[model samples]
Target: MLNRTSLLAAPALAAALLFSAPAAQAQISTPAASPKSTVTQRVGLTDITITYSRPSLKGRQAFGTLVPFGKRWRTGANQTTSIKFSDDVTVEGKKIPAGEYGIYTIPNKTEWLVVFNKSTKQGADVDGFKDDQDVARVSVKPYKLGNKVETFTIGFSDITPATANVDMMWELTGAKFKVTSEVEPKVMAQIDEKVIKNASPSANDLAAAAVYYYDNDKDLKQALAWMQKANATDPKFWNVHTEAKIRLKMKDYKGTVASAEQSKKLALDAKNADYVKMNEDLIVEAKKTGKL
Candidate 1:
Protein backbone atom coordinates (compact mmCIF):
# COMPACT_ATOMS: atom_id res chain seq x y z
CA MET A 1 0.00 0.00 0.00
CA LEU A 2 3.04 2.32 0.09
CA ASN A 3 3.50 4.99 -2.51
CA ARG A 4 6.22 4.67 -5.09
CA THR A 5 8.42 7.38 -3.40
CA SER A 6 7.97 5.88 0.12
CA LEU A 7 8.90 2.35 -0.94
CA LEU A 8 11.93 3.61 -2.87
CA ALA A 9 13.09 5.79 0.07
CA ALA A 10 12.80 2.87 2.55
CA PRO A 11 15.49 0.87 0.75
CA ALA A 12 17.84 3.85 0.70
CA LEU A 13 17.33 4.47 4.44
CA ALA A 14 18.17 0.82 5.28
CA ALA A 15 21.37 1.01 3.27
CA ALA A 16 22.41 4.26 5.04
CA LEU A 17 21.85 2.73 8.53
CA LEU A 18 23.88 -0.33 7.63
CA PHE A 19 26.82 1.81 6.55
CA SER A 20 26.51 4.34 9.46
CA ALA A 21 26.59 1.90 12.44
CA PRO A 22 29.94 1.98 14.35
CA ALA A 23 31.14 -1.52 13.49
CA ALA A 24 29.60 -3.25 16.60
CA GLN A 25 31.85 -1.35 19.14
CA ALA A 26 34.65 -3.95 19.21
CA GLN A 27 33.76 -5.72 22.51
CA ILE A 28 34.27 -2.58 24.73
CA SER A 29 38.07 -3.25 25.25
CA THR A 30 38.20 -3.90 29.00
CA PRO A 31 40.48 -6.04 31.14
CA ALA A 32 39.10 -9.29 32.52
CA ALA A 33 38.59 -9.73 36.28
CA SER A 34 40.47 -12.98 36.11
CA PRO A 35 42.91 -12.74 33.26
CA LYS A 36 43.79 -15.79 31.25
CA SER A 37 47.41 -16.95 31.40
CA THR A 38 49.51 -19.77 30.00
CA VAL A 39 52.72 -21.26 31.40
CA THR A 40 54.99 -23.80 29.75
CA GLN A 41 58.06 -25.65 30.96
CA ARG A 42 60.19 -28.21 29.22
CA VAL A 43 60.52 -31.21 31.51
CA GLY A 44 63.21 -33.47 30.07
CA LEU A 45 62.26 -34.35 26.51
CA THR A 46 58.64 -33.41 27.17
CA ASP A 47 56.91 -30.06 27.18
CA ILE A 48 54.08 -29.33 29.59
CA THR A 49 51.74 -26.37 29.40
CA ILE A 50 48.98 -24.99 31.59
CA THR A 51 46.33 -22.47 30.58
CA TYR A 52 44.15 -20.90 33.27
CA SER A 53 42.66 -17.73 34.65
CA ARG A 54 44.39 -16.06 37.60
CA PRO A 55 42.10 -14.72 40.32
CA SER A 56 43.33 -12.58 43.18
CA LEU A 57 42.32 -12.97 46.77
CA LYS A 58 41.25 -9.30 47.23
CA GLY A 59 40.97 -9.78 51.03
CA ARG A 60 38.50 -12.66 50.71
CA GLN A 61 39.37 -16.04 52.17
CA ALA A 62 40.07 -18.52 49.37
CA PHE A 63 39.64 -21.94 51.01
CA GLY A 64 36.79 -23.54 52.95
CA THR A 65 34.44 -20.51 52.84
CA LEU A 66 34.63 -19.22 49.29
CA VAL A 67 35.89 -22.20 47.30
CA PRO A 68 34.47 -24.74 49.78
CA PHE A 69 36.14 -27.93 50.94
CA GLY A 70 35.40 -31.35 49.38
CA LYS A 71 33.64 -29.69 46.44
CA ARG A 72 35.00 -30.23 42.97
CA TRP A 73 36.36 -26.96 41.55
CA ARG A 74 37.34 -25.88 38.06
CA THR A 75 40.82 -25.18 39.57
CA GLY A 76 40.80 -21.58 38.38
CA ALA A 77 38.49 -18.68 37.60
CA ASN A 78 36.16 -18.30 34.61
CA GLN A 79 36.52 -21.24 32.17
CA THR A 80 37.95 -24.52 33.41
CA THR A 81 41.72 -24.76 33.65
CA SER A 82 43.46 -27.00 31.16
CA ILE A 83 46.82 -28.75 30.77
CA LYS A 84 48.66 -30.31 27.86
CA PHE A 85 51.59 -32.67 27.70
CA SER A 86 53.83 -33.17 24.70
CA ASP A 87 54.57 -36.78 25.67
CA ASP A 88 53.30 -39.45 27.99
CA VAL A 89 53.94 -38.47 31.62
CA THR A 90 53.61 -39.95 35.07
CA VAL A 91 51.76 -37.68 37.45
CA GLU A 92 52.25 -38.71 41.06
CA GLY A 93 53.02 -42.21 39.75
CA LYS A 94 49.87 -42.43 37.56
CA LYS A 95 50.48 -42.64 33.83
CA ILE A 96 48.77 -40.05 31.64
CA PRO A 97 48.94 -40.25 27.89
CA ALA A 98 50.04 -37.26 25.86
CA GLY A 99 47.03 -35.00 25.36
CA GLU A 100 45.08 -32.11 26.75
CA TYR A 101 42.96 -32.43 29.90
CA GLY A 102 40.90 -30.31 32.21
CA ILE A 103 42.29 -29.64 35.65
CA TYR A 104 39.88 -29.89 38.57
CA THR A 105 40.45 -30.19 42.28
CA ILE A 106 38.81 -30.67 45.66
CA PRO A 107 40.56 -28.78 48.44
CA ASN A 108 40.56 -29.91 52.05
CA LYS A 109 42.48 -28.57 55.04
CA THR A 110 45.12 -31.26 55.04
CA GLU A 111 45.16 -32.68 51.52
CA TRP A 112 43.79 -32.06 48.06
CA LEU A 113 42.18 -34.33 45.49
CA VAL A 114 43.56 -33.53 42.06
CA VAL A 115 41.59 -34.58 39.02
CA PHE A 116 42.81 -34.66 35.45
CA ASN A 117 39.70 -35.00 33.36
CA LYS A 118 39.90 -36.37 29.85
CA SER A 119 37.53 -33.66 28.62
CA THR A 120 39.26 -30.37 28.00
CA LYS A 121 35.94 -28.49 27.76
CA GLN A 122 34.43 -29.56 31.04
CA GLY A 123 32.57 -26.74 32.79
CA ALA A 124 31.77 -26.04 36.43
CA ASP A 125 28.16 -26.94 36.13
CA VAL A 126 26.26 -28.83 38.78
CA ASP A 127 27.74 -32.32 39.03
CA GLY A 128 29.44 -31.78 35.72
CA PHE A 129 32.49 -33.97 36.18
CA LYS A 130 32.04 -37.61 35.23
CA ASP A 131 34.22 -39.98 37.22
CA ASP A 132 34.54 -42.34 34.27
CA GLN A 133 36.21 -39.61 32.19
CA ASP A 134 38.86 -38.87 34.80
CA VAL A 135 42.31 -39.94 33.67
CA ALA A 136 43.96 -39.48 37.04
CA ARG A 137 42.80 -38.78 40.58
CA VAL A 138 45.64 -38.23 42.99
CA SER A 139 45.74 -37.06 46.58
CA VAL A 140 48.43 -34.48 47.43
CA LYS A 141 49.05 -32.99 50.81
CA PRO A 142 48.73 -29.20 51.12
CA TYR A 143 51.32 -27.23 53.02
CA LYS A 144 51.05 -23.78 54.57
CA LEU A 145 53.46 -21.30 53.02
CA GLY A 146 55.57 -18.93 55.06
CA ASN A 147 54.11 -15.90 53.27
CA LYS A 148 50.70 -15.16 51.83
CA VAL A 149 50.15 -15.39 48.10
CA GLU A 150 47.53 -12.89 46.93
CA THR A 151 47.12 -14.25 43.41
CA PHE A 152 46.78 -17.80 42.34
CA THR A 153 49.79 -19.17 40.49
CA ILE A 154 50.75 -22.36 38.66
CA GLY A 155 54.41 -23.12 37.98
CA PHE A 156 57.19 -25.71 38.02
CA SER A 157 59.75 -26.08 40.80
CA ASP A 158 62.38 -28.53 42.02
CA ILE A 159 63.24 -29.26 38.41
CA THR A 160 65.71 -31.96 37.43
CA PRO A 161 66.85 -33.41 34.13
CA ALA A 162 63.91 -35.81 33.91
CA THR A 163 61.30 -34.57 36.37
CA ALA A 164 59.67 -31.52 37.88
CA ASN A 165 57.06 -30.58 40.44
CA VAL A 166 53.96 -28.78 39.19
CA ASP A 167 53.15 -26.39 42.01
CA MET A 168 49.81 -24.69 42.65
CA MET A 169 49.89 -21.85 45.12
CA TRP A 170 47.07 -19.72 46.48
CA GLU A 171 46.20 -17.91 49.69
CA LEU A 172 49.18 -19.01 51.78
CA THR A 173 48.62 -22.67 50.86
CA GLY A 174 50.47 -24.71 48.27
CA ALA A 175 50.18 -28.16 46.74
CA LYS A 176 52.33 -29.99 44.25
CA PHE A 177 52.59 -33.24 42.33
CA LYS A 178 55.55 -34.81 40.56
CA VAL A 179 55.73 -35.25 36.77
CA THR A 180 58.35 -37.70 35.52
CA SER A 181 59.25 -38.48 31.93
CA GLU A 182 61.00 -41.54 30.53
CA VAL A 183 64.21 -39.82 29.46
CA GLU A 184 66.89 -42.49 29.88
CA PRO A 185 65.84 -44.77 27.04
CA LYS A 186 65.38 -41.91 24.59
CA VAL A 187 68.77 -40.39 25.40
CA MET A 188 70.45 -43.75 25.21
CA ALA A 189 69.02 -44.41 21.79
CA GLN A 190 70.21 -41.03 20.61
CA ILE A 191 73.69 -41.69 21.91
CA ASP A 192 73.82 -45.09 20.21
CA GLU A 193 72.71 -43.78 16.85
CA LYS A 194 74.56 -40.47 16.80
CA VAL A 195 77.83 -41.40 18.50
CA ILE A 196 78.31 -45.12 19.13
CA LYS A 197 77.27 -46.50 15.74
CA ASN A 198 78.51 -43.59 13.63
CA ALA A 199 82.10 -44.42 12.75
CA SER A 200 83.01 -40.78 12.08
CA PRO A 201 81.06 -38.96 14.76
CA SER A 202 81.72 -35.27 15.29
CA ALA A 203 83.57 -34.00 18.37
CA ASN A 204 80.34 -32.33 19.56
CA ASP A 205 78.47 -35.61 19.38
CA LEU A 206 81.22 -37.35 21.32
CA ALA A 207 81.12 -34.62 23.97
CA ALA A 208 77.35 -34.88 24.30
CA ALA A 209 77.52 -38.65 24.68
CA ALA A 210 80.24 -38.36 27.28
CA VAL A 211 78.28 -35.78 29.34
CA TYR A 212 75.15 -37.92 29.24
CA TYR A 213 77.11 -40.97 30.36
CA TYR A 214 78.88 -39.04 33.08
CA ASP A 215 75.67 -37.53 34.42
CA ASN A 216 73.78 -40.85 34.46
CA ASP A 217 76.58 -42.78 36.23
CA LYS A 218 77.40 -45.04 33.31
CA ASP A 219 80.76 -46.70 32.58
CA LEU A 220 83.40 -44.15 33.59
CA LYS A 221 86.01 -45.71 31.33
CA GLN A 222 83.88 -45.22 28.23
CA ALA A 223 82.91 -41.72 29.29
CA LEU A 224 86.52 -40.80 29.90
CA ALA A 225 87.57 -42.26 26.53
CA TRP A 226 84.94 -40.26 24.62
CA MET A 227 85.77 -37.09 26.53
CA GLN A 228 89.45 -37.52 25.82
CA LYS A 229 88.73 -38.03 22.14
CA ALA A 230 86.57 -34.91 22.07
CA ASN A 231 89.34 -32.82 23.63
CA ALA A 232 92.29 -34.41 21.87
CA THR A 233 92.28 -32.29 18.69
CA ASP A 234 90.87 -29.00 20.02
CA PRO A 235 91.00 -29.11 23.79
CA LYS A 236 88.32 -27.01 25.50
CA PHE A 237 89.01 -25.99 29.06
CA TRP A 238 85.54 -27.12 30.20
CA ASN A 239 85.95 -30.51 28.56
CA VAL A 240 89.37 -30.96 30.13
CA HIS A 241 87.85 -30.07 33.52
CA THR A 242 85.29 -32.82 33.01
CA GLU A 243 88.10 -35.24 32.18
CA ALA A 244 89.83 -34.29 35.40
CA LYS A 245 86.66 -34.92 37.37
CA ILE A 246 86.13 -38.30 35.71
CA ARG A 247 89.71 -39.34 36.55
CA LEU A 248 89.18 -38.19 40.12
CA LYS A 249 86.07 -40.39 40.39
CA MET A 250 88.09 -43.35 39.07
CA LYS A 251 90.63 -42.82 41.96
CA ASP A 252 93.42 -41.77 39.59
CA TYR A 253 94.45 -38.65 41.52
CA LYS A 254 97.77 -38.26 39.64
CA GLY A 255 95.94 -38.29 36.30
CA THR A 256 93.43 -35.87 37.81
CA VAL A 257 96.25 -33.46 38.76
CA ALA A 258 97.79 -33.61 35.26
CA SER A 259 94.46 -32.91 33.55
CA ALA A 260 93.60 -30.20 36.05
CA GLU A 261 96.97 -28.48 35.45
CA GLN A 262 96.38 -28.52 31.68
CA SER A 263 92.85 -27.25 32.15
CA LYS A 264 94.03 -24.47 34.45
CA LYS A 265 96.62 -23.33 31.92
CA LEU A 266 93.99 -23.34 29.15
CA ALA A 267 91.48 -21.55 31.42
CA LEU A 268 94.09 -18.90 32.18
CA ASP A 269 94.60 -18.36 28.44
CA ALA A 270 90.83 -18.06 27.91
CA LYS A 271 90.43 -15.67 30.92
CA ASN A 272 87.53 -17.73 32.25
CA ALA A 273 87.50 -17.16 36.01
CA ASP A 274 84.90 -19.87 36.79
CA TYR A 275 86.88 -22.62 35.04
CA VAL A 276 90.09 -21.31 36.58
CA LYS A 277 88.57 -21.58 40.04
CA MET A 278 87.20 -25.04 39.31
CA ASN A 279 90.58 -26.24 38.06
CA GLU A 280 92.31 -24.77 41.10
CA ASP A 281 89.92 -26.58 43.43
CA LEU A 282 90.44 -29.84 41.52
CA ILE A 283 94.22 -29.49 41.72
CA VAL A 284 94.05 -28.89 45.49
CA GLU A 285 91.81 -31.88 46.03
CA ALA A 286 93.98 -34.14 43.86
CA LYS A 287 97.21 -33.12 45.55
CA LYS A 288 95.64 -33.62 48.96
CA THR A 289 94.31 -37.09 48.09
CA GLY A 290 97.35 -38.26 46.03
CA LYS A 291 99.94 -36.95 48.53
CA LEU A 292 101.77 -35.37 45.58
Candidate 2:
Protein backbone atom coordinates (compact mmCIF):
# COMPACT_ATOMS: atom_id res chain seq x y z
CA MET A 1 0.00 0.00 0.00
CA LEU A 2 2.51 2.69 -1.21
CA ASN A 3 1.83 5.82 -3.23
CA ARG A 4 3.06 5.92 -6.84
CA THR A 5 5.43 8.81 -5.98
CA SER A 6 6.88 6.84 -3.01
CA LEU A 7 7.54 3.76 -5.17
CA LEU A 8 9.32 5.84 -7.86
CA ALA A 9 11.39 7.66 -5.20
CA ALA A 10 12.41 4.33 -3.61
CA PRO A 11 13.70 2.98 -6.91
CA ALA A 12 15.77 6.16 -7.48
CA LEU A 13 17.18 5.98 -3.91
CA ALA A 14 18.22 2.31 -4.31
CA ALA A 15 20.01 3.04 -7.59
CA ALA A 16 21.84 5.99 -6.03
CA LEU A 17 22.84 3.89 -2.99
CA LEU A 18 24.13 1.08 -5.18
CA PHE A 19 26.38 3.44 -7.21
CA SER A 20 27.53 5.46 -4.18
CA ALA A 21 28.78 2.36 -2.30
CA PRO A 22 31.26 1.48 -5.09
CA ALA A 23 32.44 5.06 -5.50
CA ALA A 24 33.18 5.33 -1.76
CA GLN A 25 35.16 2.06 -1.78
CA ALA A 26 37.11 3.15 -4.86
CA GLN A 27 38.11 6.44 -3.26
CA ILE A 28 39.76 4.70 -0.29
CA SER A 29 41.62 2.00 -2.34
CA THR A 30 45.17 2.51 -3.69
CA PRO A 31 46.00 2.47 -7.41
CA ALA A 32 47.97 -0.41 -8.99
CA ALA A 33 51.75 0.06 -9.27
CA SER A 34 53.23 1.12 -12.60
CA PRO A 35 55.81 -0.88 -14.60
CA LYS A 36 59.51 -0.12 -14.09
CA SER A 37 60.65 0.16 -17.73
CA THR A 38 59.72 -0.58 -21.34
CA VAL A 39 61.79 -0.97 -24.51
CA THR A 40 60.55 -0.64 -28.06
CA GLN A 41 62.73 -0.20 -31.15
CA ARG A 42 62.90 -1.06 -34.82
CA VAL A 43 65.87 -3.06 -36.13
CA GLY A 44 66.44 -2.69 -39.81
CA LEU A 45 63.02 -3.39 -41.35
CA THR A 46 61.48 -5.24 -38.40
CA ASP A 47 59.80 -3.95 -35.24
CA ILE A 48 61.16 -4.98 -31.82
CA THR A 49 59.13 -4.92 -28.60
CA ILE A 50 60.48 -5.65 -25.13
CA THR A 51 59.32 -5.36 -21.52
CA TYR A 52 61.74 -5.93 -18.61
CA SER A 53 62.05 -5.40 -14.89
CA ARG A 54 64.76 -3.04 -13.74
CA PRO A 55 67.38 -4.27 -11.29
CA SER A 56 68.32 -2.48 -8.09
CA LEU A 57 71.67 -0.84 -7.36
CA LYS A 58 71.52 -1.28 -3.59
CA GLY A 59 74.95 -2.70 -2.51
CA ARG A 60 75.16 -4.44 -5.90
CA GLN A 61 77.78 -3.34 -8.39
CA ALA A 62 76.80 -3.85 -12.02
CA PHE A 63 78.91 -5.25 -14.84
CA GLY A 64 82.62 -5.82 -14.34
CA THR A 65 82.30 -5.51 -10.58
CA LEU A 66 79.58 -7.63 -8.89
CA VAL A 67 78.54 -9.43 -12.06
CA PRO A 68 82.15 -10.51 -12.68
CA PHE A 69 83.88 -10.52 -16.08
CA GLY A 70 84.29 -13.03 -18.94
CA LYS A 71 80.87 -14.55 -18.56
CA ARG A 72 77.74 -14.98 -20.67
CA TRP A 73 74.72 -12.84 -19.85
CA ARG A 74 71.04 -13.09 -20.74
CA THR A 75 71.33 -9.50 -22.09
CA GLY A 76 68.14 -8.69 -20.19
CA ALA A 77 65.85 -10.05 -17.51
CA ASN A 78 62.39 -11.69 -17.77
CA GLN A 79 62.04 -12.57 -21.45
CA THR A 80 64.86 -13.53 -23.85
CA THR A 81 66.61 -10.76 -25.81
CA SER A 82 64.94 -10.37 -29.16
CA ILE A 83 65.61 -8.46 -32.40
CA LYS A 84 63.77 -8.08 -35.71
CA PHE A 85 65.05 -7.02 -39.08
CA SER A 86 62.91 -5.74 -41.92
CA ASP A 87 65.32 -6.71 -44.67
CA ASP A 88 68.30 -9.02 -45.26
CA VAL A 89 71.60 -7.89 -43.72
CA THR A 90 75.13 -8.93 -42.90
CA VAL A 91 76.31 -9.02 -39.29
CA GLU A 92 79.98 -9.42 -38.42
CA GLY A 93 80.79 -10.62 -41.92
CA LYS A 94 78.02 -13.21 -41.55
CA LYS A 95 74.82 -13.17 -43.55
CA ILE A 96 71.60 -12.67 -41.62
CA PRO A 97 68.67 -12.37 -43.93
CA ALA A 98 65.60 -10.31 -43.08
CA GLY A 99 63.93 -11.91 -40.05
CA GLU A 100 63.60 -11.97 -36.29
CA TYR A 101 66.24 -13.34 -33.96
CA GLY A 102 67.18 -13.36 -30.29
CA ILE A 103 70.29 -11.41 -29.26
CA TYR A 104 72.83 -12.64 -26.67
CA THR A 105 76.30 -11.57 -25.60
CA ILE A 106 79.50 -13.03 -24.17
CA PRO A 107 81.51 -10.58 -22.13
CA ASN A 108 85.26 -10.17 -21.58
CA LYS A 109 87.55 -7.43 -20.36
CA THR A 110 88.87 -6.63 -23.84
CA GLU A 111 85.88 -7.19 -26.05
CA TRP A 112 82.35 -8.56 -26.10
CA LEU A 113 81.04 -10.78 -28.85
CA VAL A 114 77.36 -10.42 -29.71
CA VAL A 115 75.41 -13.36 -30.98
CA PHE A 116 72.21 -13.33 -33.03
CA ASN A 117 70.47 -16.63 -32.50
CA LYS A 118 67.45 -17.70 -34.53
CA SER A 119 65.35 -18.92 -31.64
CA THR A 120 62.63 -17.14 -29.66
CA LYS A 121 61.85 -19.83 -27.10
CA GLN A 122 61.77 -18.46 -23.56
CA GLY A 123 64.48 -19.30 -20.95
CA ALA A 124 66.81 -20.71 -23.60
CA ASP A 125 70.50 -20.44 -22.65
CA VAL A 126 73.55 -19.81 -24.85
CA ASP A 127 74.24 -23.56 -24.89
CA GLY A 128 70.92 -23.94 -26.65
CA PHE A 129 72.31 -21.77 -29.44
CA LYS A 130 72.45 -23.86 -32.59
CA ASP A 131 75.23 -23.10 -35.11
CA ASP A 132 73.05 -23.77 -38.12
CA GLN A 133 70.45 -21.44 -36.67
CA ASP A 134 72.98 -18.64 -36.06
CA VAL A 135 72.51 -15.56 -38.21
CA ALA A 136 75.60 -13.60 -37.25
CA ARG A 137 78.25 -13.10 -34.55
CA VAL A 138 80.24 -9.87 -34.23
CA SER A 139 82.92 -8.75 -31.81
CA VAL A 140 82.85 -5.21 -30.47
CA LYS A 141 85.13 -3.21 -28.22
CA PRO A 142 83.83 -2.14 -24.81
CA TYR A 143 84.64 1.00 -22.83
CA LYS A 144 84.47 1.71 -19.09
CA LEU A 145 81.29 3.22 -17.75
CA GLY A 146 82.07 6.69 -16.39
CA ASN A 147 78.83 7.27 -14.52
CA LYS A 148 76.74 4.70 -12.71
CA VAL A 149 73.98 3.35 -14.93
CA GLU A 150 71.10 1.91 -12.97
CA THR A 151 69.21 0.35 -15.85
CA PHE A 152 70.25 -1.43 -19.04
CA THR A 153 70.21 0.65 -22.22
CA ILE A 154 70.48 0.11 -25.96
CA GLY A 155 70.54 2.79 -28.65
CA PHE A 156 71.94 3.87 -32.00
CA SER A 157 74.85 6.24 -32.78
CA ASP A 158 76.78 7.75 -35.71
CA ILE A 159 73.46 8.27 -37.43
CA THR A 160 73.55 9.80 -40.86
CA PRO A 161 70.48 10.48 -42.94
CA ALA A 162 71.09 7.21 -44.79
CA THR A 163 72.81 4.94 -42.20
CA ALA A 164 73.29 4.34 -38.48
CA ASN A 165 75.25 2.34 -35.90
CA VAL A 166 73.38 0.27 -33.28
CA ASP A 167 74.95 0.14 -29.80
CA MET A 168 74.02 -2.39 -27.09
CA MET A 169 75.61 -1.66 -23.73
CA TRP A 170 74.72 -3.04 -20.32
CA GLU A 171 76.44 -4.29 -17.18
CA LEU A 172 80.15 -4.64 -18.15
CA THR A 173 79.86 -5.72 -21.78
CA GLY A 174 78.59 -4.10 -24.98
CA ALA A 175 78.71 -4.32 -28.76
CA LYS A 176 77.96 -2.20 -31.83
CA PHE A 177 76.77 -3.02 -35.32
CA LYS A 178 76.88 -0.87 -38.44
CA VAL A 179 73.71 -0.81 -40.52
CA THR A 180 73.57 0.32 -44.14
CA SER A 181 70.40 0.64 -46.13
CA GLU A 182 69.96 -1.58 -49.15
CA VAL A 183 69.92 0.51 -52.29
CA GLU A 184 68.11 -0.77 -55.37
CA PRO A 185 69.80 -0.69 -58.76
CA LYS A 186 67.29 1.79 -60.14
CA VAL A 187 67.80 4.04 -57.16
CA MET A 188 71.57 3.76 -57.42
CA ALA A 189 71.38 4.59 -61.11
CA GLN A 190 69.38 7.68 -60.28
CA ILE A 191 71.92 8.70 -57.64
CA ASP A 192 74.78 8.13 -60.06
CA GLU A 193 73.11 10.27 -62.72
CA LYS A 194 72.37 13.00 -60.21
CA VAL A 195 75.94 13.01 -58.84
CA ILE A 196 77.43 13.11 -62.34
CA LYS A 197 75.07 15.82 -63.56
CA ASN A 198 75.58 18.16 -60.60
CA ALA A 199 79.30 18.02 -59.85
CA SER A 200 82.66 18.25 -61.58
CA PRO A 201 84.02 14.80 -62.45
CA SER A 202 87.04 13.62 -60.41
CA ALA A 203 89.22 10.52 -60.30
CA ASN A 204 87.27 9.11 -57.33
CA ASP A 205 83.84 9.47 -58.95
CA LEU A 206 84.96 8.30 -62.39
CA ALA A 207 86.76 5.30 -60.91
CA ALA A 208 83.77 4.40 -58.80
CA ALA A 209 81.38 4.77 -61.74
CA ALA A 210 83.64 2.70 -63.99
CA VAL A 211 83.94 -0.12 -61.44
CA TYR A 212 80.22 -0.08 -60.82
CA TYR A 213 79.42 -0.32 -64.52
CA TYR A 214 82.01 -3.01 -65.14
CA ASP A 215 81.06 -5.19 -62.19
CA ASN A 216 77.33 -4.58 -62.13
CA ASP A 217 76.49 -4.21 -65.82
CA LYS A 218 79.51 -5.90 -67.47
CA ASP A 219 79.98 -2.98 -69.90
CA LEU A 220 83.64 -3.53 -70.81
CA LYS A 221 84.03 -0.57 -73.22
CA GLN A 222 82.48 1.85 -70.76
CA ALA A 223 84.60 0.38 -67.97
CA LEU A 224 87.75 0.84 -70.04
CA ALA A 225 86.89 4.41 -70.92
CA TRP A 226 86.10 5.29 -67.33
CA MET A 227 89.27 3.57 -66.14
CA GLN A 228 91.26 5.53 -68.72
CA LYS A 229 89.61 8.74 -67.54
CA ALA A 230 90.42 7.83 -63.95
CA ASN A 231 94.05 7.23 -64.86
CA ALA A 232 94.16 10.54 -66.74
CA THR A 233 92.46 12.41 -63.90
CA ASP A 234 94.40 10.81 -61.06
CA PRO A 235 96.88 8.01 -61.67
CA LYS A 236 96.79 7.23 -57.94
CA PHE A 237 93.40 5.45 -58.00
CA TRP A 238 94.45 1.77 -57.51
CA ASN A 239 91.56 0.30 -59.45
CA VAL A 240 92.59 2.20 -62.54
CA HIS A 241 95.90 0.34 -62.47
CA THR A 242 94.07 -2.96 -61.87
CA GLU A 243 91.63 -2.59 -64.79
CA ALA A 244 94.10 -4.34 -67.08
CA LYS A 245 93.89 -7.43 -64.83
CA ILE A 246 90.17 -7.64 -65.65
CA ARG A 247 90.96 -7.28 -69.36
CA LEU A 248 92.99 -10.49 -69.01
CA LYS A 249 89.73 -12.30 -68.43
CA MET A 250 88.83 -11.24 -71.95
CA LYS A 251 92.17 -12.80 -73.16
CA ASP A 252 93.87 -9.41 -73.49
CA TYR A 253 97.29 -10.49 -72.10
CA LYS A 254 99.17 -7.42 -73.34
CA GLY A 255 96.64 -5.12 -71.63
CA THR A 256 96.89 -7.19 -68.47
CA VAL A 257 100.71 -6.91 -68.38
CA ALA A 258 100.61 -3.16 -68.86
CA SER A 259 97.96 -2.73 -66.21
CA ALA A 260 99.91 -4.95 -63.82
CA GLU A 261 103.02 -2.75 -64.09
CA GLN A 262 100.96 0.38 -63.42
CA SER A 263 99.22 -1.31 -60.50
CA LYS A 264 102.59 -2.41 -59.06
CA LYS A 265 104.03 1.08 -59.22
CA LEU A 266 100.97 2.57 -57.50
CA ALA A 267 100.95 -0.19 -54.88
CA LEU A 268 104.63 0.41 -54.14
CA ASP A 269 104.06 4.13 -53.76
CA ALA A 270 100.98 3.71 -51.56
CA LYS A 271 102.39 0.79 -49.51
CA ASN A 272 99.14 -1.18 -49.79
CA ALA A 273 99.41 -4.87 -48.95
CA ASP A 274 96.41 -6.11 -50.92
CA TYR A 275 97.34 -4.07 -53.98
CA VAL A 276 100.93 -5.27 -53.83
CA LYS A 277 99.81 -8.90 -53.54
CA MET A 278 97.39 -8.38 -56.42
CA ASN A 279 100.16 -6.90 -58.56
CA GLU A 280 102.45 -9.86 -57.86
CA ASP A 281 99.68 -12.32 -58.75
CA LEU A 282 98.91 -10.45 -61.97
CA ILE A 283 102.58 -10.40 -62.97
CA VAL A 284 102.81 -14.14 -62.49
CA GLU A 285 99.70 -14.65 -64.63
CA ALA A 286 101.01 -12.31 -67.34
CA LYS A 287 104.38 -14.09 -67.49
CA LYS A 288 102.67 -17.48 -67.71
CA THR A 289 100.78 -16.20 -70.77
CA GLY A 290 104.07 -14.93 -72.41
CA LYS A 291 102.87 -11.30 -72.22
CA LEU A 292 105.52 -10.07 -69.72
**Tens digit of per-residue lDDT, candidate 1, span 69-139:** 98888888998899999999999999999999999999999989999999867786657757789999899
Return model 1's CA RMSD, one decimal. 2.7
lDDT of 2 by residue, 75-183 (tens): 6655556766666655555667777787767767788777787875534454765657766788888876555565566666775433466666555445677765454
Q: In candidate 1, which residue pairs get closer than 3 Å at backbone N, Cα or C atoms, i.e. clash?
A: none
CA lDDT of each prediction against the hidden true structure: 0.91, 0.65
Question: Cα miss at 80, model 2 (Å)?
Answer: 1.2
Q: Estimate each model's TM-score.
A: 0.92, 0.46
Model 1 earns a TM-score of 0.92
TM-score of predicted structure 2: 0.46
